[model samples]
Target: MEENRLPFDAVILAGGRSSRLGGVPKQDLVFHHATLLQRALAASAGAAGTVVVGPRPEFSLPGVILCREEPEFAGPAAAISAGLEALARHCTSASEYTLVLACDMPLVQDAVAVLKEALVPAKGDGVMARSGDGTLQPLAGIYRTTGLKKAAEELASRGTLNNGSVRSLLASLEVQPVTVPAGSTADVDTWDDAAALGIAAGNQDKKPGPAQPQLTWEARS
Candidate 1:
């Protein structure tokens, strides 16, 4: 609740098929002392409201609006659309932005603060973290609710949301891409990736703190 920070809502996309991970839901995958979804919810606790778009899991957190995409397991874009709809139900005028996140990213919390802070100066539809290898981590960003709603509606109209690419949804928006340090955008798409992050095999002692300021975009060109 910093004076300079704009109020926002949060949408955690947790409805993935996890085809490569033996059909286990990634959100339920645990790391440290919490599940991936729990970590995401904790990181976004500062938001005015939070909507988790996926099946309601046995593990619950207070104040989280749990929902699922229509047709279930549609795709990321469809999940986003579902999340936006849930967000609309609870958002107030004070909510200016929506933080979009994927549940598989265990280390995403470190990127949240910086993305929200950068969104102000960005003056764009949203601000996403760019990996050190130059990949856009769209799910790990904050977006203007108006812009996101418009995009979601347009995608639904075109009947492409169910299987559409997120890049397509963002193509029309003016986005700020801020580069982040290595591992900040690392996600568990497979057991190998999870093990690498010290999550799959239970190595919680390796958890790192937020990326150093020197490794953030603010310190780079």
Candidate 2:
């Protein structure tokens, strides 16, 4: 790793049922002429390795290790565990930290930059992003590799990761929450959210036009 770079790998959670979007895959939604998953990969491009946990998308994912949770459609916690395992098997060099991200956030690059910049001064097992409204966005966090792996192991030992909540998985860790810029952690959970982020489903082939208006932080909340 370079002197200015942090030694880390990335785990992107891309496997959600998208029940709110009526089964439309959030990762496939087009934003600025790129799929949400593609945007997420670009955001974490600095990582030593990246593993996308979910069903493989139709588009080619060059240089990405794709895998799915054991039961498929398992919760984020399970997906995270599977990502860790994939990293262990595929990554030649283990990193000290892990970037955990959800693929639905189009502006996640902003949040990733904030978390990485804050890591040097923050003292904890990880640094999680706190949105403008003070909601903790654990999915946008950077965690110590050992800490996260241990947490996953503990959860698996208790047979709880399959349907486990992210809150439960991080309960044992000491994490510093850093406030991020407005809209940095906003994600596409519903159609309204996609609209607010200037995202449209099934429009990857269309060229991006003028930049779309983004919703205010309050409006998004």
Best by TM-score: 2
Clashing residue pair totals per candidate (backbone < 3 A) = 0, 0
lDDT measured at residue 9 in model 1 versus the true structure, 0 to 100: 86
Q: Write the per-residue lDDT of candidate 1 for residues 72-134, one digit (tens) a residue.
A: 888888888888887666555537788899988888878886786677678779898898888
Please report, as a residue range, the 10-residue window in candidate 2 with the lowest summed lDDT.
212-221
Root mean square deviation (Cα) for candidate 2: 7.2
Per-candidate RMSD, Å: 8.0, 7.2
Number of the predicted model whose lDDT against the real structure is largest: 2
- The positional error of residue 165 in candidate 1, measured at the CA in angstroms, is 1.4
lDDT of 2 at 18: 96
The collision pairs in model 2 are none
Those runs of model 1 whose alpha carbons end farther than 4 Å from true positions after fitting are 1-5, 92-94, 201-221
